[model samples]
Target chain A: MSEWWTYRPSDFLLFVPRTYYRLLEHYGAGAWPWQVAALAAGLAVLVALVRGRPGALRLALALLGAGWIAVAWLFLWGRLASIAWSADYAAPAFVAQGALMIVLAALPLRAVDVSKPRRLGASALVASALAYPLLAPAMGRPWAAAEVLLLFPDPTAIATLGLLALLPAGRRAALMIAPLGWCAFQGMTLWTMGAPEAGVLLGAATVALLLPLGRTVRRRRDRAARDRPPASPGA
Target chain B: MPTTLDRRTVAAGFLAGGAAAALPRVARAQAPAPLAKTIPSTEEKIPAVGLGTWITFNVGDDADLRKDCVAVMAAFFEAGGRMIDSSPMYGSAQAVVGAGLEALGSPKPLFAAEKVWTSSDGPAQIEATRKLWGVPRFDLLQVHNLLSWEAHLDTLFAMKDAGKLRYVGVTTSEGRRHGELEKIMAAKPLDFVQLTYNPVDREAEQRLLPLARERGIAVIVNRPFQQGDLTARLEGQPLPALAEPLGATSWAQLILKFIVSHPAVTSAIPATSRVDHVRENLAAAAGPLPDEPTRTKIAAEIVKL
Candidate 1:
């Protein structure tokens, strides 16, 4: 389970642009990349929270650096002026920022204390709330909904979210249900509006939510095992 | 009396030979007539259908899949097909095709056309394409989708002049840059031009097909079934009664025949992942083509659907 959550943003980013470029070409939209970037960044934060791995943060940063270089190439060398302010442009920027946040979140800012359950719960709630807005627009109606569904939040995001939601305890339930509910609500709204973009956004967000929810469920199971007394001999 | 006897003996010998020749007379047989028109490239006439190696054969590193592809090619060859068009852009298709040919004992393909897809390395691109196909000189070398065509054309023309390549051409699919293709064909001397032309996408018929015919360049039709979209559209629909007279048994045959029946279309290269499809596509070349009126009727039938 822990093994599944670990992934580099760079690995996913390497192939994402190729698909993103194709989508941009197909739909003639400029804003698709921005949603993708925001989704990527949100995913990095989610991974950091679940795994507490500093290396994952570094990998995310490297991916962002490469993604920015690609953006520069497209704008300056390719002379595709539309890409400069396009959603494609915004996507990588969000990814880079998201990766940076993950690094910050992973830093050992204070002494470790296992007994501080209340503080940890409060911090988790605060982090989830803060990350919600960053991940929200990528899930709602308008602009490149189909492409967002097909490409954004990508496979890595889904795997990370699933890992996070698998952690032990009631917190796992909260982590799993909140994102699923948010996605379902967003999806319903998008459907009502006849907005395909909303559906695409919702799909990406659902995948993103799965990683954290999975990790949370897994953590809960582990904590339950540790807390439970050993089985009596011959019982 | 002795001199008279010698003269008489010579006359008797001539008389015997004449008598032997007069025993029976057999009528001389006439020689078989030659083909009305000579094929441009080789003495052997090429079939109107060709094969395309695109996404299907481009599966890389999977040995079992590669073997299946080789079997598909063998089936294609057995069905009396010849030409194969591939590109460097299509992953390992060229390599896979080459391996298939090697596995099948390297039967000589009538025509092999490859494309240079990228910029910045004209010579290296050509070299790599040659190495991948294991052909010393390709029959046709085209500039793929006009990606850096200007730079590649110079190298292609040089290769053609130097006998490194038998023919030089350009290809563009997906209805992209039709005007550019027209401009290049108009200004340049090319032996062939490849483009998409299925029933659904008849946009190429308005200008490109006519221009190729006028320019006397061989035309190769790609995506003859609109990349399976046409097939999906006609799924469960029976072959029209009119297609039987034109000798088309299936939709694949009907579509390929329509593309090849054009006076300018030298061949139509339809990519297929299945051997049955390759055989079916090749069978389109075996019989009489639909006449102009019949073609119009077929088109009308399709449009009505």
Candidate 2:
């Protein structure tokens, strides 16, 4: 038999793009009105995160965690597994991510950072809620097929990255792992199917991955400035 | 003698008469009887066109899509086509095909062609695949993509020797591993060999086709449309005037004709979900096939497009 590396991305994708989009449409149809609830829940979570109270952070984590579990059940297992066999394997990862979030929610809330990174994260969360659903319509698919925040994995993962950004840099990286991994897998799936929507997950993942590096750079610069002797006062 | 008026005789008479009456209606719904080709090993004749279940029938547990697949299968059988090919690797396709066969009342003419894909546990996997198809025995079971062919071929030949299978074969697709495939075709006592062969992808025409002819191994052509890419590419182009003589109305039929016209090809399995496309594919087997010069013209025309 041929080696595994000889295969291309297209080889792994069993169905066509239309079939994939139809799967989303079927999922949307089955989980109707809940999509609206999901969008509202996402907005509520974003609001809670922006407020940055200890209880509010817990509430945001709890909500995002529950949303991840729901998407795994409704979309990944219930709908996607019907078409893509790997969805069964993928659903457990989603469940694990959900479990992780809930566990984190029970922990003590650390100091929140209301910096540029946090603002960027907030913008991403807003996009997940408001702009994500419009992507289906933008791509000429029916609105019924729109991928709503907290209702689908992509937007939910992006929203998680957003909320993670609001936490201290040290606490954020470990939590970012699951959502970033999901983004890569989902992005590759869509990319292989030739769907331009892959960019949404990939772009969010790239930015989320780089945010900590950017934060570390700014911290090192600040520390150097603070430790530097008598900033030329003698001169 | 007076006809029997007993309940058993009366019921038997009604069933026989009803089946006789319903047979022609099913026949009339399809095109003319599909063309048949001879299997050199046993001289058994099968339709030149067959149904393929690669991506088309992988709709897992979806009742609506399963119904669609049943409709396609029903159309295929009504058209007198057999030799439905599938593999375990095609997601839920084997289950979908099983469901379709059950839904169609397990048509008697079904030529269940399956594959052994796993690197180990060939017998167990074949049994599982048999359960999936809901058939007593497969007409043919092949080593899928030549995976562990040495072991699986031994199992398959053993089954054939034990009368558990009617034929033994091996398969490859997308023109991959043709060298190894060629070596096996030359060495093994294979009843059938399937590979990708379309108008555009005619690499098999040079070696494998002639080798199959020499070895008396039947050729089952898969991806006759390059998994629908070739047809999609030729969609808007006009069928050459020569296609009129072959009674090909669509590009799918024209392309199928081009594949099966070769003397070495025993059957071409074109996978499709649409009812009309299945009928059209089977229809290509009907009427006159293209001659060699015409086959070249068909290939040339598709390339020019």
Candidate 3:
């Protein structure tokens, strides 16, 4: 048998890139004037988290879970799967992750407090939400072509990572897991399609992973110190 | 993944599929037969071009869209196509095919070919498919993408033995799973193998085509238009002079001819949703196949586009 390799990246593609992006275009158009409402929801989460009130993080987690579930059902299954069968498989994964987020939010874990870095992350996330509606016009795309939070992957990942970053170290790990994994997945998908946001997505995932890792290490060290017997008085 | 070969050898390598026809024929007789070719194993003659339901036939529950699918299937029969290929994984394709067959009175000589896709023993899946296609038996039952090939193969082979299925096969496309597919072809009692092969995507010509020929396995070429990429590229361009004598008029006919005319290829399945597209696609099934030299010429013409 003669040996030759003639595969191209586009050949492996199940859906046309233009067709895939057009779903977001349609979504942006459908959810019109509702962009303000989505932004308001994001602000509510931010305020709730920053206020660090009695029942804030649970409420924030519920809001986050709601976003994930909405995207899983409305965007992935309803919109994307109709065009690409591959998305059908990914839809269930999104639903599972959404459900996981809600469960993690309702649980009572270590008390989470806002730090400066957490504040920065939360502010950046809200800014991303507010900027989403303007993205299409800024990028020279047609009207209602932007990707919004809770309805698209990129902004959802950013928003989730931002919320997870604000939580105290222990709870941060659980919440970040789902969004970080999504970031990693979306990064590769965007890379294959030659989308510009691929690098940004991968970068965000790396940062998200490291943030939780740092907190976990500190928490573990504090426990180690507390558990240790007094450094030998005899010595 | 590059060859250290001259252009002539590369071109000859690609065109070799049109000349490996010494394999046994598995073709069967049909009334009012359209153009047909012999399956390398059973010598049953199937139409040169078949119907593929990858994307076109998977319209889910849309009454208006179902009418168009029915019209497309009707046009397919009118154009002398057989072997409508569907799978459970294709959303509503199997159901759509069933509905189409029903609305059309379950046209005769409809060589039903569907796949079993689950990891579990697929008797239940096969039964479901039978119910969906509304057919007594499938002409061919393949393991889709070779998913759980070992488990499904056991079920498929047993089904074939019991006379529930006419043929047993496996399908893989759009990837370099040839090593595993080739291994299964050698090991299993398979009758057919379907893979992606076209003028531009000619990697199948490398190993799968020759291996199928050597093993006397019928070859079904899927994605003949590279999932409609080649057709889109060839649109608006004048047909190559070579296409006329080979009886290819439009871009779809030209591409389908380049596929079905291959000596080792039992049939090329190019899917379409539009009745006009099916009409154009089935024309190549009856025409003179491109010879080795002509096949090379066609390949060269396509590269320039």
Candidate 4:
């Protein structure tokens, strides 16, 4: 009776990696011309952010919420659940996340202000949104194999992190939690399945999380120092 | 064409025939019965070869794939197979088995086997699984991978005592939890213990097999094909001259036979979605098992490959 830890990594794998990638290819095929659709949506979100209109972030959150719900219904619950049993539980969790986004959109906990645009952060998000679909094709897979932002998961998660990265220090840190968690999750999943892009995803997640977290910690420490009693002169 | 058929083609034909035979009731009765081994705990015998439903039968909500699995079950039973092993952890495997059996009219010979997975939810899971299988009870109920075996064992014992389960057991696979498994086998009263063992992966032979013999627990070998590694290695290789004496026509049969041939083993449940593979697996039970000397020779030759 060896312990569970004695089991090899390959032993936990229920299905081969090929079966998993086949699901991706199938999803790409099912949601064709998704490139145009994702671009249109991304552009709408971009315009709203750029115009800095009243409640622009609100609209963006609503749009993101709709996208998350769509993914939960169309992909997680609909497609993946057909192939993998874990999706039974995971689908509901995704639904909850989408619903949370909707709740956040309806009532403002964090200020919906992107008035002062951070060009670097905004560009990172837009680039991720625009370029994600090309990744699979560039890797030599068919066009039907590309992962789109709204239709596929990896790009969606990556692009979410990029967008959240632009939210300044205070609110961005809170929002980064989900995307960072998702990156860790999706990264491990792809890595276990031997996908080539897993390393890039994990690395991106680390940067996205660490940069914000490091800034937050420095800010908190500085605040504590300032709030403290005047330092003892020579003591 | 001088009545041509190579060994591979012949083997394929034999496998396909196993599937096709399921369509007619008459052909099934005429088929020869597979060899069986008795469960030492209860003296009840089951076919030496059985069906496994791990990744193979978890075709969640895929109608066409589910149909394909149904066809595989048809092939399995048509080939004289009986015991079928599954778990709740394997997604919709138990449900798929229920669906497949319903499609086939529920053969009386089916030795339904399943596992209780949770520490507290053992009874609940068992009840849910029974409803999923559309059956009243299971032939064998095991603690899945010995996950909190002690806590689950209490429920299993009560169930067996209450007549909800015929046999109470525990299982592990891919050589996982062998040391703890050894402790459970020695301390906990069990009727069955499942593990992974194949010609290429013989880690179980050292302690688990010997311990099973001493404790009088029946063994069921899983991953008998190493999840297709063995098949990939021997896909086009011709049947060795040594195989002729044992009446083995395919690599799948040869490997499965090696597993079930062990004196302590009661069955080997190899999962396969293909009807051909199911037939190939069941074919192992139809022939003579290798003796200790022959087993050594076979292992030596297989290692060289």
Compare the candidates by DockQ and give the number of the best one. 2
Query: What is the DockQ score of candidate 3, to 2 decimals?
Result: 0.08
Local accuracy of candidate 2 as per-residue lDDT tens digits, A1-235:
4566666666677766666777788778888989888888888877776677778878888898998898889888888887787888889988888888899899998767666665667666656655789989988999889998778888888888878877776667678888889889889988977788788889888877776677678889999999988857667
- Give the Å shift of residue A180 in candidate 3: 2.7
Just chain B of model 3: what TM-score? Answer: 0.87
> Each prediction's Cα RMSD?
21.3, 5.7, 11.6, 7.2
Candidate 4 local lDDT, A136-186, one digit each (tens): 878778788777776766666666666665554655555566557767776
Instruction: Name the lDDT value of residue B151 in candidate 4.
Output: 82
| Lowest summed lDDT window (length 10), candidate 4 chain A | A111-120
Chain A vs. true chain A, TM-score per candidate?
Answer: 0.31, 0.90, 0.77, 0.76
Error of 1 at B241 (Å): 0.6
Give per-model TM-scores.
0.58, 0.86, 0.72, 0.79
The list of candidate 3 runs beyond 4 A from truth reads A1-39, A46-58, A70-121, A130-155, A186-235, B1-34, B59-68, B186-189, B203-211, B232-239
Mark the regions of model 4 whose C-alpha exceeds 4 Å error after superposition: A1-4, A7-12, A16-39, A46-58, A82-85, A88-147, A194-235, B1-32, B233-241
Among all candidates shown, the one with the greatest TM-score? 2
Sorting all predicted structures by TM-score, with the top scorer first, yields 2, 4, 3, 1
For model 3, residues B1-305, the per-residue Cα lDDT tens digits are 11011323322322342211321121222223346888877888888888898867766545556667777776676556777998877767788889777765666758899999953858888898899899999989999888888888888888888988889999988755788898998887789999988878888888888888889999988888877778878889999888888778887887777887788899888888777787677767676778788888888899889
Going through the candidates in order, what fraction of the true interface contacts does each contain? 0.00, 0.41, 0.03, 0.44
Tens-place lDDT per residue, model 1, A199-224, is 54465455444434444577799999
Candidate 2, B60: how far from true, in Å?
2.6
Winner on DockQ between 1 and 4 is 4
Q: What class would a CAPRI assessor give candidate 4's docking?
A: acceptable
